[model samples]
Target: MTGPTTIGAAPYDALLLFSFGGPDEHDDVMPFLRNVTAGKGIPDSRLAQVAEHYEHVGGRSPINGQNLALMAALRAELSRRGVELPIIWGNRNWAPYTRDALIELRDRGATRVLALVTSAYSSYSGCRQYREDLALTAGSLEEELGHDLGLRFDKVRSYFNHPGFVAGNTDAVVEAYEQLRARGADLANAPLVFVTHSIPDTMEDASGAARPSYRTQHLDIAAVVAEQAGQRLGVDLTWSLAFCSRSGPPSQPWLEPDVNDGLRELAAGGTTAVVLAPIGFVSDHMEVVYDLDTEAMETARELGLTAVRAGTVGTRPVFVEGLIDLVLERAAVERGESPARAVVGRLGPVADACLPGCCRQRAGVDSGVPALCGQD
Candidate 1:
C-alpha cells in the first residue's frame, strides 16, 4: 500500500465484493444446490441432475477463486488510484457469507460500506436479488448485534455500459477472432455471435421500467462491442446476439436463439466461422466455462463451424479501474458532489440508488421486500 487506503474512500470505509457462491467439493455439491434453491421447491432428483454441471467442472465452480482474484485486483487498483479502502468479500451462498463479511466490516469500524457486485446487469438474479440479500443480512445482524454499529450499505450503479467493461469485451472478442483465424478458420466473413445467459420473459419485462432491461442492455453492449472489434480487425463483421444457460421449463419461454441453435442456423446459412463473446458475464464462471466453452463449442464442432469463446472481464485492468471509478463516483455522490460517469453506448449512468418498483416481479408488482441501497 504505497498511499493511505483511505485517500478517496470517504463516506465509505470499505468496499464489499458481493457475489454468488459455489460448491467447494463433491459432497458440497448437493448441499450447495440446496442453498441455491432453498425456497424454489426444487427436488433432490432435479437438483442432482443440475449438480452434474458442477461435478463436470471438477466439483467446484470457478466463481469463488475468480472473486478472490477480483478482490485482490480491486485492492491494487484502489491503491494505484490513490484511494485505499479495505476490500471485504461476501457471497450469497457457501463459506464467508454476506453476513460474515458484514461482521468483518463492522469489526473494522466501518460505518458505510459500498458493495461492488460481480453481476454487472440489472435483473432479478443479477441485481435486485443481491440487494435483497444485503438487506436481509443487515436486518438480521441488526437484531443480533443490539448495539449501534452505524453500518450502512450502498452499491455502485450497474456498469453494463461502462466504457471499460465494453472495451474489455471488445478486446476479448477480437482475441477470439484471432484464435479462430489461427486455426485455419476462414474469417474473411465470420459473424460475431454475442452470447449471454437467458432470463425469463416475465423477468425481461420486469427488468427495464427505469433502466435498460436485461436483454436490452446486452444488445446495447453487443452492438457497441461488435462495431469496435470489427473496426479493430478491419473486417466487415456482421453480428447477432444469442443466449445460453436457460434453465426454464419448455412450457415457459425464455430468451430465444440459443447459442447452439444459432450456431447451427449460421452453419446452415453458409456462415462457417464465428467469434462467440460471452458479453453478459463478467467472469469465467460456470456459465462461461461450461455453457459457452464446453457446450456451445461442441455444437460448433458438430456443425463443422470454426468457433472460439472469448474471455470475460475477470480481473482485467480496465474493468478493475472502472469498478474503482464507480466506487469513487458513488462516494462523490454520497458527499453531494456530482461526478462524471463514463459509459459506452446508449444508456447513461444509472442512479446510485434503485428506485421504487425497479427490477420487480412485474411492471407494478414489487416483492414487498425491504431492499437496501435504494430509495425504495
Candidate 2:
C-alpha cells in the first residue's frame, strides 16, 4: 500500500458519479443509441429497430433516473457519515458530460477528484472507457479553461465481492422467494437461473488482469445467494447462467444459453418453477426491464412455467455502504494500509485502474480513453 499524501486534501474535492446515460425523451433516443454503438458499423436502421424496445417503455429508460436517485442517496449517505465529499452526476452519452463535469469540478475548486462509475466488471465499456473519458475531458479542460488544471483522479475497484453487495443481492432473491410463496407458488424445487447482459465471448475471455471470469464471477455470487436462500427456506435450488439483451450480429457470438432457451430447457426437463437472479447487473436497466421482464416472462408463460424475476441491488442501503467500502478499501491500499475487510480471493492485479493489456479497444475505433495514464 502507498502512503497517504501529506498535502492536505482539498476541502471542495468532488466525487464524480459517472454512468452510461440513457435517452430521457423520444427524440433523444436515436442519438443516444448512436453514441452507445459508435464504431460498431451498426446502421441507423438497425438502431431504429432496436429503438422500438425503448419505445415500448415510453421511449425513456429507467437508467438515467435510477442513476440520479443513486447519486442522491450516495450524497446523503456520505453527508450523514461526515465524509464531506461533493458529488456531481455525469453521463457518457447524455446530459452532464464528462467534460462539463470536469469544468464544474474545476469551477468549484476541486483539484483532486474521485470517480465512481456504475459498472462493476472488467471490460472496455465497464472499466477503460471511463478512464478514457476522464483523460479526454481533462485534456479538453486544459484547453478550454486556459490553464493547466492538474486533476488527480482515482476510481473504486469492482465490488462484486463486497459483503454489502452480496448481502443486498441475496436479500433480493430471498424476498422474491417470499413473494412466490405468498402467491401460492411452490419453490421447493425451483430452478435458480442467474442472468446477465451477454457480451461477446471473446471480450469476456479477455477481461481482467488474468483471463477474465465475468461469467464465473456472476455465477459465484448466484451460488452464494442460492445456498443461503435454500438453507433458510429449505428448498432445493439449482443455479445456472443465462444471457440476455444480446444485440450484435448473429455472426458475432455472445454469451449463451439465452434466457429464453434456458427457460425452454427447464420447462422441458420437468422444472416446475424458476427464480431469475440478475447477478450480472447493479441496477434494473432496460436489459432487466424489457429483456427479462417482458421477453423472458412472455417466454416462460408460453412454456407454462412459473417464473419470478428478482430485482437488482440498486441504491439499497447496503449497496451504498458497499460502494463506500470499496472506495475506502482502495484508498487504504493506496495509502499503504491493509484493508480492514477481507475481499474474496480471485486472480487479478490489485489496482483501481485497469491494466494496460486489459480490455483492448477495437481497431479503427478510438477507445476514447487511453489504456493507462502514463503508458499512452
Candidate 3:
C-alpha cells in the first residue's frame, strides 16, 4: 500500500461500486426480495409474483453480472489512467452487502473511500435510501468485527446528465431506431418512449432541492438523448416520458403513463412503431427484461405496433470512459485543482452530495443528515 498522495483533495484509497443487488439462483429469490422490501410491508404473496419475473429467467438476474463487468472495467480504466486505486463492490439488497464491503475496506486498510452508485438519478430509492443505509452502517461497525473500525465514505455525484451517459443513451436509441427501420417500422414519425422505474408521486415530489427532482432528472435526460438521437438519425423525433414496473397498492399513485399504456396511446395516435429507450436504468435488469422485453412486447403485439427496447449503458465503452472522466474531475476538485465538469442536460450533474433535506423518505426517517461524501 502507498501513502496518501496530495494530488486530490479527497484522497480516497479505494472506490466502492454501490448497487441494488439481485439474486443469482432459485433459492436466493425470496431472501433477496425480503431484504429489498424489508420495511415496506410487502407480503410474500406479492413477492412471489415478483419472483416470477426472476423465475422466468431461470431464477437469475443480469444485474450482478453487469455490475461485475462494470467493476472490472473500472479497474482497468483506473489502471490505464495511472490511478492506482482498487475497486470493490457492495449491494443494498443481496449478498456482499454494504456492511461486508465496509469490513473488507477496513481490513484492507482503506480509510477514505468513494462510491459510485449504480443508479444515476435522484429519487428516494435511488439516492436517499442508500444514504440512510450508509448512516446505519456507521453506527454498527462493532457488530462486524467485535470492535469499531472507523472508515469514511463519500459518493460520486449522480451522473444522469453526464455527457457520456447521454451519448450512451443516444447511441442506443439510434441503433434501435435503425434496426426498427430495417424491420419495416416507421422511424421518422415513430414516437420515442423514454422509460424508467415508477416511484410514488410523493417520493418524486420530495426528491431534490424542494422540487420534483426525480421526474425532472428523467425528463432532462430524455430530452438530451432525444435531441442527440434526432441529430444522428437525421430526422426530428417526437418523444414521451413513461414509467414501468410499478409496485405497491393500486390506490397509491406512482409516475404516470406506464410504458404499456404509452404504447397503446401511440398506436391509437396512428404511430406505427416506437423506440423504447430505458434511460432510467444503467443496466438491463429484471425490470427491463420482464417489464419491457416480455410484458411490453406482448402489449405491442396485441396493439399491432412495432416496438423495440433500446439497450442500457451496460459497460459501453463511452459510458465507462465517461465514468473515468467523472472520477478524475471529482478527484481534481478534492485535490484543489480546477477542472471542467461535463453535463448534457439542464439540471447539470447532481451535487457530489445531496442537500440536507434532499430526497427525504416518504415517512421521513430521523437518521439526520448522513455524514456522506458531499455532506462534508
TM-score of each: 0.97, 0.90, 0.94
Tens-place lDDT per residue, model 3, 287-330, is 99999999998999999888888999998989998998887787
Stronger candidate by TM-score (1 vs 2): 1
Candidate 1's residue-wise lDDT over 1-376, tens digit each?
4646574778888889999988778888898889988987878999888888886689899998999899889888877777768899999988789989988998899988999888888988888889899988888888887865577889999999998899888889889988987887767688889888998888888898777788998888888998888889887679899999888578988988899999999999998888888888999988888898888989999998878788998988988888888889899888889888888888787788987777876777867787888878
Cα RMSD of all models vs. native, in order, equals 1.4, 4.0, 2.7
> Which 10-residue window of candidate 3 scores lowest in summed lDDT?
1-10
- Greater lDDT among 1 and 3 belongs to 1
Clashing pairs in 2: 1-336, 2-335, 2-336, 132-369
Q: Least accurate stretch of 10 residues (summed lDDT) in model 1? A: 1-10
Candidate 3 lDDT score at position 121: 88
Judge candidate 2 against the unseen true structure and give its global Cα lDDT, from 0 to 1.
0.76
Each model's lDDT: 0.86, 0.76, 0.83
Query: Once superposed on the true structure, which residue ranges of model 1 sit more than 4 Å away at CA?
Result: 147-149
Q: Which stretches of model 2 miss by more than 4 angstroms?
A: 1-12, 144-146, 208-211, 345-350, 361-369, 372-376
Point out where model 3 deviates above 4 Å: 1-10, 143-147, 210-212, 363-371, 374-376
User: lDDT: which candidate is best?
Assistant: 1
lDDT per residue, candidate 2, 246-289, as tens digits?
Answer: 87879988889999999999999998788888887889988898
As for candidate 1, its clashing pairs are 5-84
